[model samples]
Target: MSWIRSWKRLGLFALLGLVLSWAISCGSGTPPSTTGQQPSGKQEVEFWTMQLQPQFTDYFNQLIATFEKENPTLKVRWVDVPWADMERKILTAVSAKTAPDVVNLNPNFASQLAERNAWLNLDEKVTPEVRQLYLPNIWQANTLDGKSFGLPWYLTTRIAIYNTDLLKQAGVSKPPATYAELAQAAKQIKAKTGKYAFFVTFVPEDSGEVLESFVQMGVQLVNAEGKAAFNTPQGKAAFQYWVDLYKNGLLPKEALTEGHRYAIDLYQRGDTAILASGAEFLNTIATNAPTIAKVSASAPQITGETGKKNVAVMDLVIPKDTDVPDAALKFALFVTNDANQLSFAKAANVLPSTVKALQDSYFQTAPVNATPVEKARIVSAKQMQSAEVLIPAMKNMKQLQKSIYDNLQAAMLGQKTVDQAIADAAQEWDSRQ
Candidate 1:
């Protein structure tokens, strides 16, 4: 059975590699290098980004134009890749020595890339003044082992998105503040409205999103020694908490396979009364399903186990072998600067990663939509200072994350008791090492 599983995993990865290779072969050409002594005249830099389409195109273009006007001799060529294909494409480009001058990446992936020595250290490029402009926590996320490889582009944090109409029907006067209150409220919402209390998509291979919250609840997935520790007392309790919620029918069984989009859809259709997601969901709800926009965003209730709130950050980084390191750094700073940060915040509803941008008039006094962006912005900003960083085990995080979540899914589905599932996960983690 183990051998069969290994073969299946290898096959899946092989298929992904083939698909990535095919995509890279069709691209226009290799991304140009902008480093190694500035060109005598025009220095053209290639900037690659993930699908920042219709909403962010104008703002990004404007920022580029302004930067070019100021720099005069430097020119930037922007290439956009869809998010679905981003990881595969970027890795292929890097391996083929055809990578972009600069690239934007999520913080979670940034750390992994840095571990492989794939990103350039930006410590020397950023001046004290430039560093001061960004939020302290945002800057910290971009640094790994004393090297700064990326800049914080935009920030996001999860919040409790509740259906106001459903709450009213349930006779709940307000959102819950404690985990106990939240569970009770969920039960009440379901009894009165015949809808699930909360929607969370938990899958074995895709557990990072939900695991982030569990970590915030004081469940340590890894110990200080960087060893897998999710089978500990804290971790077991956190797993049991979710399992109980599932057994009580307060959560949907589909959560085992659902993704963020699916949960958002359930919230929009009023099939679920609460969702734990980022601010982007507000824009999505408003645009895709207007009725759901009527819901309100509030701070997520604390876990009874730990009173601390959890926020996960997505960071942007520059790869080490980037051809135009200077140009890449400049562009990274430009995009994350105060002016452009506000533009991105307004258009994408993402919290700005810079302190000044977050304090700007647009974010400070932005008008309330039915699902006010302010709620998320305020909560994220307040929590940013103390938010826990996402630090999975560096050595075998991919395997460890998969093992922990596979057992978690089993517990959630009643296939195994929480203790049994956790014990199994620990055994798997040890064997893999």
Candidate 2:
């Protein structure tokens, strides 16, 4: 989930409960040298990203050069923002009418601002033919009330990273492909290895993996009126599923408080058998735990009956009040065009959101001698055909996450019954409305 972006930038996905943003907060690192504008008298299209600098410096430096060469009248000033500082800083900048012309943000982070009409309407600017360049499902993730606010950028889809040793110890030849199989495997792993099969933090403020699970299990989170729709039998079953796991001790105790980072640590240390994370994390695993990396393997992420998968996207948006809408829009499109996106994806080891870019042979094929990381990339890219943002962007997304997570935690802690928890969560969600 963090690029490791919420999943690689590792900031956004690691934070996906926080890394894998969708964990798309700002970071506190040094930016690329491609900063500071000159008095060249060219209209500057200021660009901001969530800590993509230092690492992608050369790629961006070349990107800016190409965009400037293409649009000679418009100069580009790239500013890389920290993960935690982006929201506050950008909010302040937007308030002061000094927001960047093209900014990087995810759906969840920008939904509230979208409700306030703080962003430009891409539907009015991006032509129908141009809009088709992106995956329709991914493009819809950036829309609210039928208006597009951002251009689809890079994406990360969770994959099942498993420790083969752990699974072999538990006598399982294949990783669990469904929740039923996962539950069974969880029990087996714990019984045999005395280690949890997986770690999913129950902290209401944690990643939305559990909430996304509810959807995968065929639980509708909202109705046509936006009221809670998760108090049904399916919701109760989903709640009980986790409660049973916690109570049965199939999950790590730290799950109640820890987050995605902890989950990754556990997996890397061989304490948890599986990690629902982005493929780019394989690189981190190879570096931080080389021994474990040798035995690590990837499977398609575990799913419920619906067979749905979660995707995190980092998009490029423009402020409605910017003086250079055309310039900003042109730069945004240029940066996200097929060729540019493929280059960035290769350099960064993430997936592209564009239909054409994703079709590139790099993402579509893997050599026979591909390492685990390379194979994981091929699997993740192939999965792009079916993956989507399970939890959509809405003004109340955080609240929804909080309500469900809080009630689920209560159930896990024995403070509430499964039915009571489901009903209360629905009630809490409705009360807020």
Candidate 3:
């Protein structure tokens, strides 16, 4: 009986010891039991960016590498897709619940995404310190319904880049300051130099930039109700202005088929005397055709009717599914901060989106062709302060822009009269609405 009791006591003591050991292990912060198995390594985050191939590929890769080096515990993988297919791919990924952990997108889509609750509300993530890094205007542009969706990574604006040699050849000493002056100059240049003086890449059916030109001319495309209001008297007048230019032989017929890229190429190749485009063209010229580097750029002339300068904006946005929202927002803030903005601006020949960066010493310094770039930058900065946002009709904006330009092109080719083209375009715009 004594031996049996001893064995029972020994068994009870062993059980207590085991229980204590298990408790201690838990208290020591041993890995908790997960449903399946423990992950082998640190968390990996997938990031997607709009097509950043050959030109910006290295810069972006280095930036990501630096981010990983600074964050040893986090791994970031990148996916690059071309701009044309980006929206479609991203939407597909979102639908499949396979969206990237971080995404960079344009601001125009940010509002739509926000409306659909497809983007993270960055207001909670971005600190006041982070907000101060970008220009107020850009920050506002990315904000929809009082919430910020993304940061402005880089920015570009349209400026009138003209062929200085052509201007000299035409005996025009100065660039046009107003639309009327521009028209008069265009007439004189065409008459004397036998070259198109102005090119409008406005295609009513597909050219968003052409619509932007109308907006710059103070033609409101939509009212408070978001209905298409571009067929108003002011809109008609703006459309007529383009028709007049086409009829007078001041603009090329090719402009109807030419989008922004085509117009920039024409000016770069010295086929046209003037082009309204972003500073990215500067780098394009430097890389593609070194000889045309002598061409200069100036502020896009204000129209005689509206006296308003037009500037288009591009911005950055965060998608809804970013896992490390805080860290992603911080990185965005870091990149757009004044110093990083300067770095990007210099690398891309794009204007800085922040006030501090724009006023930096680098931008103030005159380039080889100082006058035009400086003038354009100053005017663009001012215009950006009051730029209007374009919200197209509910259906077929691309078709509408194409139709307007197709008719105008016909007019330029002498296949239709200016009145006929304008009337037909108006009818088409009305029918589309």
**Every candidate's lDDT:** 0.66, 0.82, 0.59
**How many steric overlaps does candidate 3 have?**
13
The candidate maximizing TM-score is: 2
Task: Give candidate 1's total backbone clashes.
Answer: 7
Residues 332-367, candidate 2: write the lDDT tens digits: 999999999899888777789999999988987888
Clashes per candidate, residues 3 or more apart or on different chains = 7, 52, 13
Scored against the true structure, residue 18 in model 2 reaches a CA lDDT of 25
Q: List CA RMSD, all candidates.
A: 6.5, 3.9, 18.7
Over 1-433, each residue of candidate 1 has an lDDT whose tens digit, in order, gives 0001111121111122101022243665454445434556767677776655544568778888999998887888777665556677777777776677778666666677777888877787888888888777667767767787788776555567777888889988887766667789888988988888777667655435556656656777766666567778878877887888888999888878865556667888888777666554565567777877866556653434456554444456676776567777787778788888788666655567788887776554545552365665566556555554444415666677678778888988889999999999888887876
Kindly give the stretch of ten consecutive residues in candidate 1 with the minimal lDDT sum: 1-10
lDDT-sorted candidate list, best first: 2, 1, 3
Model 2 off-target regions past 4 Å? 1-39
**Cα deviation of 374, candidate 3, in Å:** 8.5
The TM-score obtained by model 3 is: 0.76
Report the C-alpha lDDT of model 3 over 1-433, residue by residue, as the tens digit.
0001111111111111100011222232222222111164555566666544445668767877887788766666666554445566667766655666666665665565666777778788777876886677667767766778777766555556677878888888887766667888798788778987766665443335556657656677655544456666667777677777877768887766654446656767777777655544454566666676666656553444555443334455556765565555555665577877788667655567787888876666556756444555565555555543343213344455566667766766778866677677667766665
TM-scores for every predicted model: 0.84, 0.92, 0.76
